[model samples]
Target: MKTLYIVRHAKSSWKYSGIEDIDRPLKKRGIKDAHLMSKFLSKEIARPDVFISSSANRALHTGIIFCENLEYPLANLQINRQLYSFSDGYLVKTVYALDDAFNSAIIFSHDHGINTFVNKFGNTPIAHVSTCGIIGIKFQEKHWKNIKKGKTFMVEFPKNHK
Candidate 1:
């Protein structure tokens, strides 16, 4: 089986007006929440074999926090620009193209696309995925290429636990 952990980047700060949206950093609350979520994930789920994330500042920072909490080495992370504003199709394609050596993977990105991807594959009915929220989906297939929509065995979101 393959597991996909879809994590939405933590809330960003608007204090810096001139900075581009792609360069916005996380807020104080976002940092706390990222740490909390990371602790929760580390205790509840097995460490991901692969970590993929958007190159955007907030997303990359969130991924770093997650990796820190999970004890995943920094070298294992793959920062992909395509994940910055990926559509559902693009997200799925990216997942499908993952190396088969990885049995579990984490995708740290923004919402809308993450929401659409989870809802498409896992039947989640959320309106907005909270900052630092994680949705875990289990696929029956052994390889990522064999994964398909509506084939998820479970979906776990942070709000659902709270």
Candidate 2:
């Protein structure tokens, strides 16, 4: 079995209108929310074998925060540029290409990619994956490419704490 955790990038600061979307940093709320969610997952969810995230500033930062709480090494994270995507194809491809050595991985990306994924692969219907939201899916297949759908293992959002 393989476990996949999909995490949406935390709230971003729109203060810098001139900056590219990929360069935007997290807002104050985003920072706090990341920490909260990270702590929550560290206690509740199983520690992932590998952490994969978008090279985008916000997504990488969110992944780093989760790594800190989970006691995973940040430098070892797999940074994939394709994760900085709105389409679900890139997201699926990235997961399919994952190293078989790792049975579990945490992927940080954006929506509609995140929302599209959770709704399609998950057993339950998800309207959207909010900022700092996480959806976990457990696949019955051993190989990533063989995976079609999975049972929803867990879902967590920043709002759940508040």
Candidate 3:
């Protein structure tokens, strides 16, 4: 089986208005929530075989925190530039291109795209995935390319921890 872990990037700070959207960093709350969610995931699920994330500042930071909490090496995380935009189709295409050697993978990205992707593939319904939110979908197929619809088995958000 192949599993896809969808992680929405934590809340980013608008304090740096002068900076571009891609450069926005996570706020204090975002940092704390990222750690919390990561801890929650560590206890609730198995570690992902690979980690992929958008190169944007907030997304990358969130991925790094989760990696640290999961005891996964930061050097192993893969970055994709297209993930910075709201492109769910492209995101899925990237997942399809993943090496079949990895059974499970986590993707850290921004919303609209992430939110839409989950609702599309997930069997459960969700209005929106909050900051630091995580949704896991399990596919019956062995290869990433063969994965189409999957059963949504995991849904986690900041409030669940609080």
For residues 1-162, what per-residue lDDT tens digits would candidate 2 score against the true structure? 999999999998999988998999999999999999999999987799999999999999999999999999988988999899998989999989888888999999998988888888889899988999999999998898888889997888899888
Q: Estimate each model's TM-score.
A: 0.91, 0.97, 0.97
What are the per-model C-alpha RMSD values against the true structure? 1.9, 0.8, 0.8
Question: Poorest 10 consecutive residues of model 1 by lDDT?
Answer: 149-158
Residue 7, candidate 3: C-alpha displacement in angstroms: 0.3
| lDDT of every predicted structure (CA atoms) | 0.84, 0.92, 0.92
Would you give me the overall lDDT of model 2?
Answer: 0.92
* TM-score between model 1 and native: 0.91
Candidate 3 TM-score, C-alpha based: 0.97
Q: Which residue runs does candidate 2 get wrong by more than 4 Å?
A: none
lDDT of 1 by residue, 1-162 (tens): 888998899889999989899999999978888888888889988899999999999999999999999999988789988888957766787899999999999999888898888877775566767888888888888789988754444444545555
Q: What's the ranking of the predictions by lDDT, best on top?
A: 3, 2, 1
Report the Cα lDDT for residue 68, model 3. Answer: 99
Model 1 alpha-carbon drift over 4 Å, by segment: 150-162
Native-vs-model 3 lDDT? 0.92
